[model samples]
Target: MKKSIAVDMDGVIADTETHFLNWYEREYGVRIGVHEIQGREENEMFPDKTVARKFAFTPGFFRSLPVMTGAVEALKTLMKSYDVYIVSAAMEFPQSLPEKLEWLKEHFPFISWRNIIFCGDKSIIGTDYMIDDHIKNLDFFKGTTIMFHAFHNVNHNHHQRANNWDEVLKLLVK
Candidate 1:
């Protein structure tokens, strides 16, 4: 039996939090914290869906985002042993998920779309292990949850915490 690992995209594989924060601050003129940015409650921040859609459709959002340190290398290592699948929240804008995945592939060519899951509900996807940065998602998963720490999630206390992708790889391999 082949083991399966589910990986998150926004903060886990790609360091998109910074880019999102910058864009939010520039467009909304509000100095939002990283926690609020990743909270997934856009209604609290943006008054309407139009603004949210604008943010999602913004060109270069994918290109400007940076890959998380050691994410590509660690994924490569994990792929050697387990079936690694990327489970990410779909962008509100049309075609955003496909476009972003393409951009991500340019950076990490090892990942394929067949192994990617673009959905809002991650718990529905079956996987043996999960590496994510969100506390809510971690709580929803009933497997080995490795919390990837970020400035926003510094206060969250989980049984497993990985400061970087290398640490995550080490934990999974063990």
Candidate 2:
């Protein structure tokens, strides 16, 4: 039997930061660079979280995000041995559900719908491994946690880190 691995969509496979940064500049006229995304709190980048939070409500915000480099290829390689599941804490933004599903289908059609999980809490995930960017999720995961490197978590170093797909291959692909 293959070990099952849970993967987060945003930051890991989806380019969410770029979408937010572009919206921030167009919506608020603030030019925030990727260098400024080092904060642990995502909303801290903006003067007020509402500025960013408000944009989350925008339609299609999560639908068309660009895929991260090497993610598709890495997963294709990993799939040969592992049961890959797309697990996302997306219930917080109910509107994003369909969009996320669509985005995943467009980019990762190899993943089956049955393997996709969109829930409110991640503590219920029962898998052999989890690849996520949030410390909150990684801290509670009862498995081998692989922290997918994201701008917000650059300073964090507790869990095993996979800075990019190449690193993820070495860490998970054996």
Candidate 3:
């Protein structure tokens, strides 16, 4: 069987939390702590369609987001061994998905659209390994979940906490 790897876009491949927090604060007029969003339910973070729609329409949201450290390098390494696919959550507005995808392409030209998989439920994708920052998704994947460490997730202990992409590459490639 061909080996496959599913990568999460927002947190794993890109440092989107910073942009998300900034956008949330600017739009909602309230500073949302990363910790508050980390373990909570998704609905609690984005309560209604209004909030979701606002996020989707936010200008330069994708362009402003930062790429995670060692993400590209790690992905390059994984690409050698497995079919790497970006299995991310679909945006509330489908149009927003393409923008986010374009942002990813601009940042990492090495990644192609054919390898990208945007969907709400990633568990159905059937990858041998999953690299994500969300603990909930990691739990759902039930594979060799490599938890890419972030500020909010740092406190939450996990079996596979990759401090950098080098470590993640090592784990996945081995």
TM per candidate: 0.78, 0.95, 0.75
Candidate 1 lDDT, tens digit per residue, 80-174? 89999988877444456767778678987878878988887677867998888878788889788888876656767865999898788778786
Candidate 3 at residue 149, lDDT? 75
Across residues 61-171, which tens digit of lDDT does each residue of candidate 2 receive? 888688988999989998999999999999999999999999989999999999999999899999999999999999999999999988888888999999898999998
lDDT of 3 by residue, 81-154 (tens): 88888888865447668677778778878888888877876667678888887787787776688888765576
- Clashing residue pairs in candidate 2 are none
lDDT of 2 at 107: 95
* Candidate 2 positional error at 29, Å: 2.8
Of the candidates numbered 1 and 3, which has the greater TM-score value? 1
Candidate 1: regions farther than 4 A off: 21-54, 91-95
Choose the strongest candidate by lDDT.
2
Candidate 1, residue 90: Cα displacement in angstroms equals: 1.1
Instruction: List the candidate numbers ranked by lDDT, top first.
Output: 2, 1, 3
Q: How many residue pairs clash in each candidate?
A: 0, 0, 0
Clashing pairs in 3: none
TM-score ranking, best first: 2, 1, 3
List candidate 3 stretches off by more than 4 Å. Answer: 21-57
Error of 3 at 96 (Å): 1.7
